[model samples]
Target: MEALFLPQIQQRNGCSPVQPAFPTKVYNGHSQETIHLHPFMIGPVTDTKVSLTISNGPKTLQLEVDLHDTVDQLKKRIMQERKFGGSESISLLYENRELKSSETLGQQNVKNQATLFIVHKCNGG
Candidate 1:
């Protein structure tokens, strides 16, 4: 039928697939599987709260961080707790994920009580 061939031709022509006016979701794999995600938040600063969780480590701490704080500040806080040196490399994780150095908690959409994991980065050459 024309309808069947039209989609193929459109694909060959590099045309985007037709989308519904309203948002639609299609599962590529494990469509029937249901996932339950626990909610968390980031805190400490008064302004700009983020909802995230840090489950990267065995022990999890729930707190809020101010978006105004830079990645360096966060590292410093973690260092104070762990008592690491100034030159040591530290990284932050939001929702069990790594955060880009340039990104702030506010920019990344973090929320209250979001668990953030602070880890040290090891370099060997």
Candidate 2:
């Protein structure tokens, strides 16, 4: 029998395991610049932590949210903690990136001990 290798699975976007190519840039000697690139790794299936930082009025509060939930569910938890109404809007940021309400915590590809930024909506006329 011939040896068989497991096929590489594709991401949700249907893209294969294609490597990213970085183009070289030439800069003037007098100018100084810094370019930072973080390599993305395929994380294991594990329980992740969701942290939140909120700006309510003039104070900032930080709290931890459970990752076994959707973004909207987390918002409900925050609302309860802050004693805010259920209709109050909120925002979730993952890795300094913003996520929509329809998105879930796991769908964002967050790993263990991930820090999520929670911002309560402050509406002013």
Candidate with best TM-score: 1
lDDT of each: 0.56, 0.58
C-alpha lDDT (0 to 100) for residue 96 of candidate 2 = 75
Query: What TM-score, to 2 decimals, does candidate 2 have?
Result: 0.43
Q: How do the predictions measure up, each by TM-score?
A: 0.45, 0.43
Per-residue alpha-carbon lDDT of candidate 2 for residues 38-117, written as tens digits (9 for 90 to 100): 33557776546656565445555576755567777767767777644466677777777787676676777755555556
lDDT of 1 by residue, 15-60 (tens): 4544434233334454443232222335663656544444435754
Candidate 2, residue 65: the lDDT equals 59
Separately for all candidates shown, the number of backbone clashes (residues 3 or more apart, or on different chains) is: 17, 0
